[model samples]
Target: MANLYKLDILSPQGNIFSGNVKQATIPTTSGLITILAGHTSLITMVSKGDIEIMLEDNSVKSFTVIDGFLEVSDNVVSIISDFAMKSDDINDEVIEKAKKYAAEQKQKNDNVPSEIAEKNLQKAIMALKVLEHNKLKRKKRVKY
Candidate 1:
């Protein structure tokens, strides 16, 4: 059996997830990082991407997170995100809206910071990727 540890994912809305997980892969500013039991303690800034957790039961859960901070200590992992949503919760309408808003923001030549537009675009793209990946995983499981 794999070692299990506590994982808590938090966002401004509320606690997104809290459970025991065998492993977790997070997107950091530098790159993607996978944490397991007994891993060394660390703290880093999370990037816009999918946070994948492998549960003790061997099932996987995925969440799309925007900018945030992640801390690992004493076998406990905590994620504080500005925004987060389960991949299954994302819908086409929301994705399309985000894309349109981002494009509109980018086209504006006013004082709007480009970072805002870029962040929106990144978030939309990341959500789509996570949704696609989850769909593929489900298909594979069905085939087996």
Candidate 2:
């Protein structure tokens, strides 16, 4: 469709996704931004949050983006994230454990950098939020 655009999402681990999507909603440092096919060409820093992508078939896929940069140009979108993974691929238990670890370390008793500890906690929280959102979406589908 004319409204769809090519999207590429990548991280150090590997390419997360590459396909045509009807639209994409990303969380930036400023706020949430929704990009369509004809979005203005620009780049911005993405915050820790879920990236929701609506595919050409209207099905939605979500990924957790810890931090990154997003670019839009010529009807194509590119996202390069420091850390990212599919919602389904993430383990909530592991994230929760990380959150606890960060919280414990945040006390400054272990002499760990508070910034790093805080960042880890924030990432774990964001990942959990994305996982929760995905679970709710799946539940809604089952009700239909």
Report, for every candidate in turn, its global Cα lDDT versus the true structure.
0.88, 0.87
In model 1, what is the error at residue 44, expressed in angstroms?
1.4
Against the true structure, whose lDDT is highest? 1
**lDDT value, candidate 2, whole model:** 0.87
Per residue, candidate 1 scores C-alpha lDDT tens digits across 1-144 of 559999999988899999999999999999999999988899999988888999988898888898999999999999999789888888787788888888888787657787887788887897778768878988998999
Q: Candidate 2 on 1-144: residue-level lDDT in tens?
A: 789899999999889999999999999999999998899998999988888999988988888888899999999899999788888887778687878877777775858876787788777887777777878878998999
| Clash pairs for candidate 1 | none
- All candidates: TM-score: 0.82, 0.82
Global CA lDDT of candidate 1, please? 0.88
Q: Candidate 2 has which clashing residue pairs, if any?
A: none
